[model samples]
Target: MTQQEKNFEGSLKIRLYNTKSREVELFQPYFAPRVGIYSCGMTVYGYAHVGHIRTYTNSDVLRRLLEYAGYQVTQVMNVTDVGHMTSDEDAGEDKLELGARREGKTPWEIAEFYEDHFFSTIAECNITRPEVISRATEHIGEQIGLVKRLEDNGYTYKTDVGVIFDTSKFGRYAEFARLDLEGQEAGARVAVDDQRRNPQDFALWITNQPNHIMQWNSPWGRGFPGWHIECSAMAMRYLGDQVDIHTGGIDHIPVHHTNEIAQSECATGRQYVKYWFHSAFLNVDGRKMSKSLNNLYTLDDVRARGYSPLALRYLFLNGFYRRDMNFTWEALESAQRGLARLWGACAELPAPTGVVIPGFIEKFESAISNDLNTMNALAVVSGVLETKGPPESKASTIYKMDEVFGLDLANSRTRLSDFWRLRGLRPEHKMQAESMADKREKARKNKNFSEADRLRDRINNMGFQVEDTPQGPKIVPMFDFDFAAMRKPVCGHCGVDEKTGC
Candidate 1:
């Protein structure tokens, strides 16, 4: 290993929320020198809601920070296109079917459309993509393979409704649910499903009817894989029988992920997951933003209401991931104004005097190392902003902290209105991006368009794309960037040149 990789993991502590512990514990991967992660991705029959963003971006940031901290991470995300039903019980219509009816398209079409949108939103939020993109439909064979393993192990039983997993066989099935044993036996909590053998048993596979538009033949007959089964099968197929981490929303704790554990552990006879990370809900005006409540917000909803996608991400980071965050347009506007200053802070980066603020940096690292205490870590970033130091050190600290905040702070001159105000540029990020355009005027005037285009390529690599139109080359940000620190070269098309004329 090179110095970058080697020096990265010298007993450095990271705390993660373990569902098993139900509290933050020091994060220790099952294997040293390698890490495996599995995140429950969206059920792609519809556009992702704020609820979706909560978990997806939370896990996304975690994975990125993990990599930034020097651990090699293999992350897998399941694209849940099949097997999810309207009811957690084995009886309702498939979620895909419901989505198709609502949208007047085939389930496959709905999946494709919404899946694309999901990816776009996540990427816009600056979440990194996983290494292995596993689709539940693509892993039918693997699901069947796992189901067979459970069947052979005597943990599965066929019934009139479907191939149900016998939770009685596992006996320890409800442990992950964190329910009191007495309350579970009395059915005192939660929506009840009497059909589920022991109030905890769940389906491994659901037999499909001939009229169903999305059914496939399986070892158990024509059926769809169970919702929980798909995640388990896809996760194990990619990460192995045991995984370092499994992440999803807090909503999944009661049924989806808990059942996943019962079935996965029943099949493999081993610990299913070491760490379970879940993000709390993002409330709108002190009320939970939920589909049933008709309070969900779409990306367009947020934009029309006049907030960037990132302000919402910032709002989330203010409160810890394990705690609920309330959203008000006023709050988001404040975040926007605050982040605008963040860009100016980056633009103002000065040289490091090599005077280490050990006291402050230690507190910051301590926050993150403690179960990714992002709220506190954010406090550290704020403190860094307040420190009287060389711009280089302050800027360097902000960049290191972005590894956890995922705020793109180092490159968000575009996101900050103050940045625009300070630079005397237009409010729109694209306008600021033009100021960061690369200079190729010398090469272009020399008619070495090749060199000029190469310069354009370099600018694009820095996340600005230029279009040569009759009006001249218009530069736009492919996304946000730290414009002040950007090496804005002279515009070739605009005839701006360094040391020579276009």
Candidate 2:
């Protein structure tokens, strides 16, 4: 083997729970030294809620961890601009069509709008964009090709509505979901079309009705691809017939992912994916997040309450990816405070200079390697901060941790400065504000309450707010900067401020 191969094989191993095996196992790539990852991307019907964000964030962390472990990772995320139905069972109107009708626009327009919004919000949380972002609507030909292969292979049969995959032909149909065939057969007749060969059988293509808006001419009689077929076709088209890893929400397991496995494997007669990773749900105030409950929150909702997007990211890191995360404002506030404390620590140190502390790095790698146990990984960060070490070492170590954490710790000082700049203060005003805050700190230390209050009022009057911290005082602008006032030039003709006439 080449030296590079040896290095990757010997690198700190990453372990993740495979939903297929239902056990945490060492991650072995199908192709050594290179990993192909396929994550189910947003459906793009509307603004993505926090529940959706949590799933994608977990996948991002997994990708980041693999990259950090020295794997050449090629990631593909499929944007479902078409085919996904209101009912996951392929029985209802397309979500994109519904959204388009509601907004009085084309389905294509609605997809583009929400897809842009989805990326914008996830970017706020520092998610790395996938290498290949395949859209279902753009890959209709590939989807039809895959279904044709399945049909030719005798794994698909014609249904009144479309071509359906014959789950009865795939012996391992219920393997991943551990479904009871008899039970499924009994319930399937009542819940779905009785004409289906088997209750568990799913559609590969859905024949469009007269009013369906996103129809494409296909071998399956001018129909659209089914929801499950999109990811399988796109993944195989981009990443090959077999991939290293596939990730999605747990909700995909029983139907979506299960069907992907069946179709992909039956088409190629090869194992489709080596590892299947699924993230659990997000609950709001101990209840499942739903529009009916009026508890579905978007990234804007978090920002509306003055919380940073990374703060919500930090909140997710506090829990295991495999466990359902309970979201509460109180819990989120706690995470925000914790993140601020870490950022505060970063501000006290200079730019990273020294090598990463070996002990801390080991513990962090170990934590993340063990099934992406980020909660424990975060505790290691807290431990590193409290360790008595050179300032440069701590900063350098935290910077290394942030690679996997995606919290932007190394740029905390810049973020802090920008925080104040957004409120209203100019660069010079920020400096002056800090100087006054130092004076107020000394005044309070000397027990001069009157003087301290006086200094506080003086800073506030200058349109800045001071927050006293153990490290000293942090200054922020009290309100939006009056840029118009700041832009007022001195009137050269009158020797006074142009706007103020002073």
Measured by TM-score, the strongest candidate is 2
- lDDT tens readout by residue for model 2, 1-502: 6564565677778888998899999988876688999999989998998998899899999999988888889999999999887874666889999999999999999999999999999898898999999999999999999999999999988878789999999999889899877765455334667778777788889885767898999876887888889999999999999998999999999888998999999999999998999999999999999889999999898876656788889999999889999999889878877876777789888878988999989999999999998999899888888998988998999899889999989889776555444334466555656777788889899999898888787667556678877777888665433422543443322223557552
**Residue-by-residue lDDT tens digits, candidate 1, 1-502:** 4454445567557878788778878676776556899988989987787767777778877886677666789999989998777765566788888999998999999888988999888877777888998888889999999989999989887776678888778777667886665565445543666556666667788885555688778777887887788899988988899999998888898888878888889888899999998888788889988778787877767665555677777777776788888777788778766665566576556544445466677887788778777788888887888878776777766777787778887666555643243333333344434543435655676888888877676566545678877666777544344444444454334323333434
Model 2 residue 464 distance off true place after TM-score fit, in angstroms? 7.0
* Candidate 1 Cα errors over 4 Å, as ranges: 1-11, 180-196, 350-357, 417-502
TM-score of each: 0.78, 0.88
- Kindly state the number of residue pairs that clash in model 2: 1
- Name the lDDT of candidate 2: 0.85
> What's the true lDDT of residue 323 in model 2?
92
User: Cα lDDT of all candidates, in order?
Assistant: 0.74, 0.85
What ranges in model 2 sit over 4 Å off? 1-7, 88-91, 185-191, 418-449, 457-502
lDDT of 1 at 405: 79
